[model samples]
Target: MRAAVFDRFGPPDVLHVVHIPDPQPGPGEVRVRVLAAGVQPFDVGVRQGNMPWAKVEFPQTIGQEYAGVVDALGEGVRDLAVGDPVLGSTMLNGNAELLCVAAANVVRKPHNLDFPTAAALVAASQTASGALLELGVGEGDVLLVHAAAGSVGTVATQLARLAGATVIGSASFDNHSRVRRQGALPVPYGEELIAAVRDTGLQPTAALDGAGAEAIAQSVALGISPDRIGTIVDDKAAAEHGVRVVRAGRDPERLARVIALAAEGKVLMPVQAFPLSEVVEAHRAVESRHSHGKVVLIIEP
Candidate 1:
């Protein structure tokens, strides 16, 4: 099998494509023939050693989420079968031709979704959905999504709207129209952001900080309930600021909902694809912090 392998991680340039041994499934697990892999901010952070809190082994294969077919199933796995289309998350090791995943971690891909969209949903979309659930957002509420044009923000805005919330999204002027297209009232992110949202007379009842920017802290200062604020960025100051976080190892139910929404075309994933051999470029694109969508790797034809 060929994979993007890195020894002593430093930057995206450290990643190289090379032949590696094929992984096998264990009991209650399945081996997926990877079709598409989602590149997340965590993937880049793990590769560049920015997440010192997370200990990763050397020669790591970095990827967080993927979509593929179950080529083989381990003993005790009965709900799935050979050739089942699935999307899932792994603590590591998704950026390859095959990955062994616990049966519980994998879900059948929505019948109407393609592999790329399925792959993109697990990480970003799920986080967005889970955040909205945590904040208790619903119909008639005003929800504000920071960096709403990004991968998670885009899905979150749509999900909020679908849940009947009035949604406001902050992005650069360049992406305002795109956010509006997703059913969010677009507000330009910067000094004028708060006022722009205020002009609409929508007092935000909840907030999701996908931006990881200083502006997020400022938003919290505007008097929305701290319990209603959550961030995917895992900023250390969240607790002190009375904000919440969506961390690793959450229950998979929120993710499952996001997958269903994608299949139903109620949610969207803007994604850019690169061949598996170009994993480094994909990482660079993610690290650039200007990607308008999720960056993904096409691992199989």
Candidate 2:
């Protein structure tokens, strides 16, 4: 099996493709033939050794989520069988042709989605779902979503709107149309953000920062309750500012909802697919933060 492997944290150039032994399913686990693996910003942090607090176990396999078919089931795994389609996330080791994970971590893939889109949906969508819940957004409440044009922000806007909150989103001026397509009122960042929200006379009751921009704190200054403001990105600063924190990487329920939405077609993931051999480029694209959507690495057909 071929996989993207790195020994030390650095740039994308440090990633290399090599023939590694195929991973076998252990007890309560299953081996999946990878169809597509999701690339995330955290993956970049891991590659660069930036997250000293997280304390990554080195010689690490770096990927957080994937969509694929079960190729083998290990002992004690009764619910999932060979050939069952599934999607989920983990701490690492997903960018490969085969993945071995515990059965409890896997969920049935939604009937409506393909592997590529399903691959992109789980991580971002889940985080967004958790964000909505953390803010306690409700009907008649105004929920401000920063980075509305990005993947998680787009899905978060839709979910917030579905929950009956008036959704307002921020994006660069060029991506305003994409933001609007998600059913939120789009406000461009800069002078336009505060002015645009104020002009509508819809005072925000809660806010979620999907963008890591420091300006999110400024948006909170615009009369929204500081306690109700949460961020998926600015975890460290959010705590310091008395804002709520929604941990994007961990929550299982959040990941599950996103997977269900993808399977049901209620949520869509824009994907740029790269073969497993191009994992380096995929990692670079994700690191750049300029890609239109989630970047994924595909393997098995």
lDDT of 1: 0.84
Top candidate on lDDT is: 1
Per-residue lDDT tens digits of candidate 1, residues 1-301?
A: 9888799879888999888899989999999999999998888888888889876887777788989999999999999999999988887788899989999978888778999888887887667767778789898989988889989888889988989999989999988889989999999888888789889887898888887666567668666888888888847758668688865354567688778877778888888899998988898899988876788899864
lDDT of 2: 0.81
Local error of candidate 1 at 240, Å? 4.3
Clashing pairs for model 1 are none
Best candidate per TM-score, number?
1
* Model 1 regions lying over 4 Å from their true place: none
Estimated TM-score for each candidate: 0.95, 0.93
